[model samples]
Target: MSIFRNLSSRAKEDELMDDFSMGGAELSEALVHLRRLNKIFAAPGPTRYGVEKLWRMMGSPASLSVLDVGAGSGDVNRKLLEWADSRGVELHIILVDLTEEACQEAAALFKDEPRIQVQRADVRDLPDASADIVTGSQFVHHFDGDELVDIVSHMLRASRYGVVINDIHRHQVSYTAVWLTTRLISRNRYIRHDGPLSVAKGFTARDWKELKRRLNHETMTFSWKPLFRYAVVIPHPLKPGGKESGIGYA
Candidate 1:
């Protein structure tokens, strides 16, 4: 199939970062480039949007604990910390990734920061209700079919409040833009190959709708964001006599 066509379905090809055993200089370089690209594309926007929306919906809690799955380099949460500081919210973030290298990278990045912790583990193994919020940034597209559903179910179960997913939006324009941008700016082989591939692996509106249907959750809300991304927020059900909260979209 031509790379330029057949974007109607999510791509099944595995990214180099999918291998947890990958480590050392090459992986380190790739992580660095990934951080830069994420910043350049404002990739952290969706996660912040989801979290803030949920926080407000929950009546602007004074503190929040977030579990960030597949948290590479912990760059996104680093930005989250800044946002929390500005808003006077006490934020504790746990960054989890399957790769030892990623955990090490995050550890080094957040070493002096007591607000963040880095762990190398499978997200599925996490205990239920471990955090107030669970977030997956550019993470969920790595799996498909039953695995995808299972992973998301675990995320929802692991969070006391909700789960936020920030992922790519599969489109011809996004794929082409990423393909060219990575080639121009990144020398790391992983970044060059996986950047465009991530777009192809991204979700469409119908894809999110189907996943939501399969999960049978009524509180889930998803919306498109600038720069070709989707922010999916699933708030936990309110207790008896609890008032519903509003979600503001971008």
Candidate 2:
């Protein structure tokens, strides 16, 4: 529970914990509005900044690949496409999620684009592998404690480049901002419920530290970007010769 305090935003989901926030037409509507909501209410800085940083540090994305775990509706994937296009980098995106309907919707959005692939699966059950970069947005907070550690390990193992988890920071200020923003801009029921719930389940830098300590590797770093009432977390890749990569490995 102490770790739970680190992610105060998740506390609000108490009223709506049963909602999968995925499935059926409601899920589709949430997916649509969420993309709009993120653009208007939860955008990640000036777009190419984070990806740019990774490229500068890692060399190039000319051959980079990315995996979006729990890619609800391709909003993040859409952003990735934009980033790749802007940077002249070739990106191969694998979108995985628990709900087939959501993944199917995402696939429809990018089916014609050979660079993207979608799968209906739990991230935890997925295989360990490597990609130039691995990323996820608005989805990490759904995991806490050991579940969070396991997911991070999966990301680390699956990425040859790095892992970037962009989500909300769990704090009173972030929670308030999100709640009000959802009330003001979005009109979906699942959005209204899952929006605040996401905040409550979010992780703080301190919580991340505890989770990292549990891992077999000792060379991971965690970077935080708390902006526009949201949080951008970067978990760097583990060094092949070193114990493991630091945070923001994506």
Candidate 3:
């Protein structure tokens, strides 16, 4: 288990452990713990920053449609909706995930929010240009290098404007920090295991560069954010008429 604290672990292969499949009451509890950790760490900050950056670079639209891959419990989408409302921005979100349980959880979470829709489908199967902006939060680390590139391409193809992938940055400090923090605050076994393992499985700067190179798109920009996260924003390659950028590929 201590090996999870080492950044070198990512060199072997992507971690195959997935807590979302645990299902039933245990999965719900784990998801709840995960959401709280996401909030405490400000996981939604990068996605919001990406959208704001888009508005700064491209003109703002009156309304925006967002496709969020691996939406989990849709906690991030809920936060984004509140943020959009405060700014008087009309935002609609389609939360796509492969798990029926996750889709059901998200659907229930956003049932009162008319602007959000929950779908159970693989992101790659979604039609092209399905939304104005495509986004995923803490989701990309689940895939291997090639799979990630392919997923990004699909995301870009489905977007009218851009894509933003917010994930962790693999580093010793982050691995240790997340491990200690989760151990102290969370009793959920899944969180205790997945937290540090996620940091180990996260991407490095070189990994992000390779992913960008594979996409062969010049518009993509990568940055490191606070709380040991990575922000990969790819603005629309073409001129925009519109706007906006989930959880697991697992």
TM-scores for every predicted model: 0.92, 0.78, 0.87
In what order do the candidates fall by lDDT, top score first?
Answer: 1, 3, 2
Clash tally, candidates in order:
0, 24, 5
Better of 1 and 3 by TM-score: 1
Q: Please give the lDDT score at residue 10 for candidate 3.
A: 68
Candidate ordering by TM-score (highest first)? 1, 3, 2
Worst 10 residues of 3 by lDDT: 241-250
Stretches off by above 4 angstroms in model 3 are 9-22, 238-250
Candidate 1 colliding pairs: none
User: Which pairs clash in model 3?
Assistant: 70-247, 133-244, 135-245, 136-246, 137-246
In model 1, state the lDDT of residue 190.
91
Candidate 1: worst 10 consecutive residues by lDDT?
Answer: 241-250
lDDT string for model 1 (1-250, tens) is 2347579899998988887677688998899899888887889989999999888876788999999998988798877888899999999999999887788889998899999988888888999889989999999999899999999999988988899999999999988888888887888889988998899999999999999998888778899997899999998765448743233322
Residue 99 accuracy (lDDT) in model 2: 78
lDDT of 3: 0.77
- Residue 78 Cα positional deviation in candidate 1, in Å, after optimal superposition: 2.4
After superposition, which runs of candidate 2 have C-alpha atoms over 4 Å from their true positions?
A: 1-22, 45-50, 216-219, 226-250
Q: Compared with the true structure, what per-residue lDDT tens digits does model 2 show for residues 1-250?
A: 1212345324533323235663687777777777777776545542234555655567663766777777777665666687778878877888887776678778787878899888787666766664656676776677666767778778766766556666666676666777777777777787777776677777677666776577644444555564533333344535568555433433
- Measured by TM-score, the strongest candidate is 1
lDDT of each: 0.88, 0.65, 0.77
